[model samples]
Target: MEPQLSHHVEGAVATVVIRHPAKRNAMTAAMWRALPPLLEGFARDPGVRALVLTGEGGTFCAGADISTLQGSPAQAQTLAMAAEEALAAFPKPTLAAVRGHCVGGGAQLAAACDLRLAEEGALFGVTPARLGIVYPASSTRRLVSLVGPATAKYLLFTAELIDAARALGTGLVDEVLPEGELDKRVAELTRVLVSRSQLTQAAAKEFTDGRTDRDAHWAERADGNPDTVEGVAAFLERRQPRFTWSVAAPGSPSSSGSPSSSGSPSSSGSTSG
Candidate 1:
């Protein structure tokens, strides 16, 4: 069966599932191509404030479908890179909820997300070395940025699969939960994110992603935004802030599935695995 990307939205959280259970959720070329549009939809939907990426059948993703590689290597790589970049650039916060194997391209996709929450038994690796394939420099840099150069080398050079504990220790994953607790934890976290100020999250995301310089313009832009006012007022009142900022608008260009032009945080494209 062909692999697929399934999207489900409830309230402010969207869940993107990668399904290819026959091969432990290995991503097919078509699935890679499908990601950008699906992610675009979520980004434009003001109702969706956060996203959770995971794999079907208790496994995250094993990587690119190797069977398809012999047919169209270049196309496969190009599409995969495009999807990776889209995930990285998504304006809202993204979390990778990993359960089982997350290797090769799967590992790259997880690395692209803003945060990763893994099951204690989850396994992660970057296996291009084992396949005699060159890992992309951009991805390497991201890995280095996460785990530092020495640990990045240890993973890439050896192509060894690391357990979730080791992954967390190396900074590969942000959190590790017990076997059955991942979904609950992720859902709770996304809910918190959704209830917070979108304006503040968006600006913080841009700065942390290193896409914007700190300047007076940031302060200028926030001077009278409703979110800012509500946040401050709520703090003074000792009550939870009801943030209402959203990206959706009638006739907004984003609604048509075009890339947003609002200078929102965008993903840095992924390097081919």
Candidate 2:
């Protein structure tokens, strides 16, 4: 059969599969070209609330399918960049269900997701430097913004293998599970996410997207909000930070006692910036 992107829906969650198992699920230029419209369809369809990205066989993604670029490097590069851009702009909350060998462009794919639920055996790296290619500026910035300068440089400079533990320590993967139970874990996460309100998810995503710049907006929210106050108060009280990041109308706080919840601070790096 001709290679194609596969998607199946179960309730409010949609699973998008990279179906070319013969290549260990390495992404093709065409597949990358198709993601934006696919994601846009999901975003506009009210029936879908969450999406999970994964591979069909035992692997996640190996990187770009170099074989596909034999005749068109320029086209391949353009397609890859647009894919990453679309993924970054995907409005709904996205999760990456990472399995074996999430390396190179695969790592970029996972990094594009809002959260990563990685299998224990999966590996991650940004391998453009090893291939004499420049990683996209936006992708590089996204990586740097997620793991900070030191860790991002360490990956890009070395192009070395990183395991689940290292990924967790460096804030790469959100959850890691044994190979046997990875699917179940992803399913559980999808179930929970499907129950959340779209407005809340979009707001949280927007607020996070705004933090990419070294600007005054991020500063004000992180430094001077009631959420920050309450979070700190809760921390001091030996209680959980009751993060109230809901989609209340502007100036109409969710609760009278808690004025506003500031955006999350610098340390908790999500998959996005």
Candidate 3:
């Protein structure tokens, strides 16, 4: 069966499931190509505030489907690049709810998300070395950005499968949960992410995504806006802030943000600034 990305919306959260469990949710070439559009759909959907990425059947992911590659190094690498581009460009807060065996390309997918939550016994590794493959530059840079060059080099060069605890320590996984508690923890985290002001989150993400690395004006362009002022007011008043998302809105005569009606913090993928 073909791999698919399924979405379910709950309040302000958009849960995206990687429903390719037969391959342990391993990414197929087609699945890699499908991510951007799915994410784009979520990016523009107002009902979605934050996105949760998880695999079906408790297994997070086993990376790319080697069988699909037919032992073609070039083909496998291409597939990885396709997946990398889409995840990296997703304009929202993305969380990876990971479970058993998040290794190889799966590890890279988790690394691409804004944050990651892993099951206690989940394993992580960059197995390119094991297969005599050269990792893509974007993935390599992202890994280094997360855990630093030394740690990135160690993981990539050794291809050792490390425990979830070590993955957390190395800045790979943000939080670790026991097998059964993963859902509860993710739910709580998702709630927190959705409740925050999207304005701040989006701008923060823009800069965080390294988009601001070469743009001196990015910070200035994103730090504050009308919605941010409203967020502050809402905080002081202890009321829900009415976020305006259109350029043609009552107070937002020139606004433009994803999720059209009003953007939740998730839409900012804030790394865009």
List the candidate 2 regions with Cα displacement exceeding 4 Å: 211-273
lDDT of 1 by residue, 14-128 (tens): 8888888789999888788878877876788777789899998789999999987888777777778888888887778899999999999999899999999999899999998
Clashing pairs in 2: 227-260, 227-261
Q: For each candidate, what is the lDDT?
A: 0.82, 0.72, 0.74
Best model number under TM-score: 1
Error of 3 at 218 (Å): 6.0
Per-structure clash totals for the candidates: 3, 2, 8
lDDT, residue 75, candidate 3: 79
Give the per-residue lDDT digits (tens) of candidate 3, residues 149-250: 999999999999899999899899899987799999999999887776565566567678765652444345345766767877998999988764422234
Between candidates 1 and 3, the one scoring higher on TM-score is 1
Best by lDDT: 1
- Ranked by TM-score, top first: 1, 3, 2
Worst 10 residues of 1 by lDDT: 264-273
Q: Check candidate 3 and list the clashing pairs.
A: 92-269, 202-270, 205-270, 205-271, 206-270, 206-271, 206-272, 206-273
Q: RMSD (Cα, Å) of candidate 2?
A: 9.4
* Per-residue lDDT of 150 in model 1: 93
Q: On residues 66-128, what C-alpha lDDT tens digit does candidate 2 reach at each position?
A: 897788877887788877767766656789998888888888888888999888888888888
